[model samples]
Target: MTAPAALAGFDEVEAYHDAWWDEIVAQAQAPAEVDIYDKDWRFLSTVDDAISGDFTDLYNDAGEGKLAQLAANPVAQWISENVTEAEDLHVRVTQSHTEWAGKAQTIEESMDSDGFESMNISFLHDLQHAKKIYCYPNPFFLLQVQWPKIYPYFGPSVTGVKTLLHLNLLRRYQPFWRLPADIFSKTAWAQDFEAANWPHIVNPRGTGLFNDTSMHCIIATRMGNFYDVVKAILEDAGLQLTATRWLPGDEQPFPEYATITMPTLIWDVVDKGGVRGKTGTLLDGFMPFVRSILGDNIQETKTPVPYEEPQEYSEDKWGTVKEVPAVVWYAAQRYTTATGTGQSGIVKWRKTQHKAIASAILTGGKSPGWVNTGVKLIANAILGYIGMIFLNPGLALGIFDEQIEDVILAFARADLTNLRDEMGRDAYGEYWESSGQNGFSPSTLAAFRTGQMAVQPYTSFQVEVVNGQPYWYGMHAVMGDRVSMELGMSGVLYTDQIRTARLTFGPNDPVGWTLAVGKDDDDTSPTARLARVLQAVSTIAQQIAVQS
Candidate 1:
């Protein structure tokens, strides 16, 4: 989480005053000629500025931008640009939880358990890489904070603001989707994983800011028999693969799962629908799916009220006319409650409470004074102490978040039966049926689970190879000593290309980069504020002791 910001009702009061004054002045003055196209013309000019500006400084100030630059390094760029052209491509699959497979009937059963890359079993298809690469907590949020200069041009309208967001999304988030192909080669594939793989979803994007909603992935439509090779290897180990689906006639798949169950594909969708970067509109074709899920839009209008007569219009020429009303037109300003789940307005009440609590953090719920800062410091310290100690639930040690996700999915009656099919879980599910899963002996999961095995891609093919033979091997980063594997495949896949490629160039690993941003490791982050509070408290205590 984030610290609550101080509330400055001064802004609200100033806004109301400004609106009232402007309306009164307009009522007094003669109407002037205005060009209807002026706003449109200005908007077009602003868009041009956005396209032409060198926002590197602006980007440097944003956390997301820093991560994007990391992913766009030369090695990652090479993998992203070249892998698409390769005929065969392989994506490493990762387990959702550390110990989810522990409950399985056998090692083979655990190998086929549901994981993050099990989209072929969960959603039936995977998102396309190039077409859908939008990440959120909106990178623009940070950029706008750092560079307010651009906001004056783009903040006037919803379209303008969203346009700015879309541009930032494309520039800062595209690289997230185009991450290095073999970065996770050491990891194992989930059951039902096919030609497409979305590794970004697993690591770098794991930060709370990105979450599962980040539409970043790799779809292997380019050429190559890597899928066939992996299929043979997996089947030899008595593991079945479900075919992942693709859209018909080259239509791109849905970018995120939230988009799948959305009712309408409309413009108001804040973040859902269609290929992310491919569409030119703001948020691409995505809409505010969150609002829709909550309920119908609740637009409430307040009745207009008149400004006080003596104080507001006493000195005006029309003051004597009782008929003259100095009404503040905005007294009727509308406020919408987008969430109307009909829980007796509890949602709105909670939002209000949250907003007030956030405001009180910075202001200490008091007027400005010399002691304001001290009060805020004390308030934060007290709250922080309470939260970190008494209020906090015990740390979730050794518990994988994926286990919770599995429970939720299970309660929702999610079916995992489709994951056990012999072929990839696509329309062509039977294409590889002839290749039986009886070639290799069962219980071979130990090879992948018990050793210091390093995954090495074939010199010429997408499959991993060792001593001129296709082999399966991987190491657990946390428990490298526990499991090892060296499985067999039919072909002699070479390994020269991946071995020679520069895969180690980077400022920081993407996953680590995500975890580092806004983390306590930084002196300027929220943790620093707490440190300052502690120092202040210590100083005050020392002064009191000296006085005594």
Candidate 2:
């Protein structure tokens, strides 16, 4: 459940003016061209001047001993010389998030509390490590917002400004698929994961930002066979394992459940799809990163226009846009039934404040905003409907986001049924055969994972006989949507990848100015803004998915 955002015609129109002015001045882009290609093979980002400043003042201001240790390490020095050579590229090598798992009590307690990792399940500890890593809200997952039906009415300036920001977001977003492997390729998390007994889906090249990396995992066990499998690998990767007798807070009898996480495989992405840090991807061959691939930094920022504080609706004066849940938005037509006095014109997305426009448009009314966004939204809705029709495939991913995602991992449903093999097929085959569906049927057990959603990948697998060759069909589920086990007769699967899925959700994904989107724990960095919009797109994807 999320607090709503409101957007009205006047405010939306005003912001349109600002974005238009900003674009005319070319103030909405990267600040400078970065020399990142030389280090593109690795999934690392060049530190910007801001991060460099933080690095320079780190020891005196932050007293992080890890930097002191790394500044002395030979490997760290080598990384500095070859990869992080830019003044802005200043960084320090630090240990992975294995340390938390080494100690067992936290796991025990976190299980007791209603908790799940907020970011990608597997990357939870890394993100929290706070030395080299930082956490951003799952930008795609905001629960309460949706795109409006009147979008076809917005003027060109409004659409143009939005398109500009949206395109920039997409460009910045597409290349980040390479970071996980760069962060973890040298560690045991990736190594042991590859050798594990469970069937897993991984990009053959490495971890993909857009690929599903979930695999079957036993989150915790008294049995060494299961425990050792994870423990040894994690320990080998220098991660510590935790054990417990009681749950985290209350003295509840806590047992273990299946836990899995996505892993890195960047080399596979390039070797296979050739998305080597390029804005656009070419599946047929490699597209190397060059200076041309990276855009110049945005040095100047447009000062945002502010809206007057929203007062209660008054007919004489226009009111703040009404906000409502996307699922129940149509019910809000009472707020602004189209009077037909004048044409339904472009609405204002409130400045800084998020509000819904009054429902003024009569049904079937025409507007450029609707014409523009309506077609796209309808197309997306149709696709979502088709997805639901194919398989009520009873599993999906969700996180209980307390402003940020690492708070909790939850399933939409969880009912366990041991497939009684009446017709005598393998477990999955028998189950699907009995159910008369190609995948798990809708049930309580639709989506369930033990720990945080971001760090703990759900434990499920798809066995596909592709051309008589048995393969593990990748399993990816996101919050609020039906389980899309779309083995699409090709390697292209569902959009559990937040970046891919949210954009696919059309209007449900909140698209507006960076600061106006759901607050990313108050972080306004370009990366954080990217996380908000990009993650919001995918986060809301489930909302669109379930509703459409």
Candidate 3:
């Protein structure tokens, strides 16, 4: 009888494997820009730059030689010719930490008691003796004492000593172990040490402990010395270092090295958006979104402020003066709280409104139509509240027919069930049939669709303008399926792609408004600031009307 098909055989299915491999390669090579924008609207250019630099440097510096060999002696060729030998070499290099630690200890003891007069001399001796050693202490400690004048000659003396110590220790304990005795000769070692420490001796004004230039200098110096050491050792072993050396004319090495020094895409959305190369704007489309939320008694004039008091009848005092109603500052503070920069007044305001709006939109049973209606209602409510605060009360009452009385009438007129259905359809797919399966109650579904999943009883509602025409927007909170509390005619306004207004309502009763007029001609008008403030108030009133 034929043996039943083994499960292990399925793993080697050629077609299946090939398809997966293709997908993997495509994913690896995908353009990076797609992931540059995160959910919170934060830019990821700086993070990408940091990760890319680290990844490329590690691969090129450590694996370039092996990669080159793989070209001439392909993987298939190597496997067929010297698989066993390669396996043995890999095994030898993979020695256990315990075994290596013992060997390192022996070497350390051998060089420990060398009683050198100066710290530099003792350090050099220990470094030479160790198969692998890393100096943990800062090099500045020695530099300050041995060469006091030289301390100021180097860049900012923050962590240079620590870095030098780390690199020197790595040379002694790790990479140096790979070097043969001929490469470890006194002259080569000294040259390597000097090169490794030279940059610290030069530029010192670093913003952080590890400056980029300083790091580059350290790496180049150490690598150059290491190359020399390896070259000498290879010659002694009847192998030519020149054979491994990537000559100046070599394209392969140059590309790999260039990759190491490539500037990362560092972007600041508030300033310049993307990686800059010496001149010109680095970031693209990075201007801050500016809006005049509220202002009063403001006037625009071409005339500059007087430097001195004007005489009683000075004719020079004639200039345009436009009256503004009130003044309100609306700003976007992008400073990160993670960096310990506490939230600015503007940022705090944004957070409050964002949370409130999110809560209001996502609080009801699951129904697409109902959900959309709810979202619109919630937006309307938010906008209405904002409008009421800034709009004239007489105008607000006319629009709603009774101001306070009409606010409740509008909420009662809203088809909560239909609104829930619309919201679900807009937010979730049509496939979501409210089957009462999955323990989903109508109210639970509504809440989930609206994003009001919290068990603590709360109300969900919103207000928004439907057409290009201006309208009242507001919301009311309810508990136990009944309106327990309401906020009315708080703010006003309609949504325009070119012009937008935002108002933030806080628990502490703090209120703020943002009016973005875009690049319109009216924005520069003498009464622009006051107009903005009035617009914000109008929007706030509309929000309160719906919310209440």
Candidate 4:
């Protein structure tokens, strides 16, 4: 009554596949949250903590299990889906390879402008072109074989154009195809022709080349012997290249795609009901404003007064203690006051008591007494009177100045206080009240903002002088993952402050795109403006620091 040995393997595979499907479906249905941050407007310190604590927990509980199931199921389905008609799969594979070879020719032709000579071939081009060529007829079969095996069951259930687009995009980078090959085969290249036609054949066991998650893994596995392939291609084409390796076991096939939830803070700050129209509302916009002030000659100074011991008090017979009053005295010069008793002949018990006492003073003895102590007190009183006469308008102006400066510095220091106003005013007032119909509370908005800022891109300013004058320079302004902004002069300002100015972009040469500093040069693009502010702020900060 025992089951056949062959049936045992099939049973195990079926069970694994079923589990994988369950995992993928669970992942797709799981609830996700995204964190938003006002990188330009607020400084966030607690973001990393929140990500590790709250986000990580949520991901583990709600996402990981389901994704695992989905990724696992689809892999098992691949063998049954495409292996049934290996002939069709081979024809599709051949067409794909031919198309890829044609595209490789185009890539080589493009490289000619940059002095690039074709050398070793790129598997990415081959895969991408192949997918494009056989997109319509191949996706369903390919997905059955590739998706589950490569991404686990969580790979998107795409067919036709969508499938082609995904495959083509994935293959252009080499990171995508190499994942399956690395997990399934010992020699990825040995299986290239077979995989080019039937990717499932490359990794029938669903273990080796099929599981790689990182793009780098694909590159390494495909062209490990030729370290110079990527370098040569990118260099020859004059393209910047930044590459890194994937974590160990990361290349293994997973059941689902990692779902990144948007942080509540993004909605709170960015929603119409949120703090819209407020200064520094747009995280991207606020950066330049901050640089405008902090990048300049802004300095902070602190003067410390030595602590003096408090005079002790004496108690009466009732044990009620009373402190004696002390008076602060000031004098311009050392002058002794003498008390004499003029009585006809009675030497009024003349007791000469001379005690040394130093007066508390701000300045050395100089000028008139009125100018030393009296002037400061008089100035203060006059200023107070003037303030009253102006009905606190001047005071309001002063307060406004301080607050504005605070906003700028808060951004520069990336202080948490920046989020306070954003959460209270933007998220709570605008987003929740207007958009969410008051369903969201201020506390919730605050939490959301905190989460959002955690993931936003961090920017740093770099300054360089062009045309023998100073200008702002910055990088990685708006978004992460290779997005950046720069500012430069369009023309000479010809103003009292600056003799001349020009605008340009940073992380790029300023040869053809330079803008004159001050004149009405329409070439003063956003990048140039950003550069200007960055340079100005940097200059100001350096000057202030030096002066202090």
Provide TM-scores for the models.
Answer: 0.15, 0.16, 0.15, 0.17
- Per-residue CA lDDT of model 3 for 112-145, tens digit only, reads 3554211100001111222122232232233224
Order the candidates by lDDT, highest first — what do you get?
A: 3, 4, 2, 1
The digit string of per-residue lDDT tens for model 1 on 1-548 reads 64344445666778899999666444322221111101111111111001010101000111101111223234333333443332232221121111100000111111234431110110101212212332222333443343221122211122222232233333453432332233222221122121133212221111121222222111111011222212222221112122222212323333322112211111110111112344444332123222211221111122345533454332422223323321111100121224221121101100011100010000011122223344445555665677678766333322342222212111111111222132234412111111111111111111121110111111111111121011111111111111111112211111111110011112222111000100111134486468546744654354234222
- Per-residue lDDT, model 3, residue 409, is 15
Instruction: List where candidate 1 sits over 4 angstroms from the true fold.
Output: 1-157, 170-548
Poorest 10 consecutive residues by lDDT, candidate 4: 55-64
Query: lDDT of all predictions, in order shown?
Result: 0.22, 0.22, 0.23, 0.22
Instruction: Supply the TM-score for candidate 2.
Output: 0.16
Deviation in Å, model 4, residue 431 alpha carbon: 8.3
Q: Which of 3 and 4 is ahead in TM-score?
A: 4
TM-score, model 3 to reference: 0.15
Instruction: Sum up the clashes in candidate 1.
Output: 31
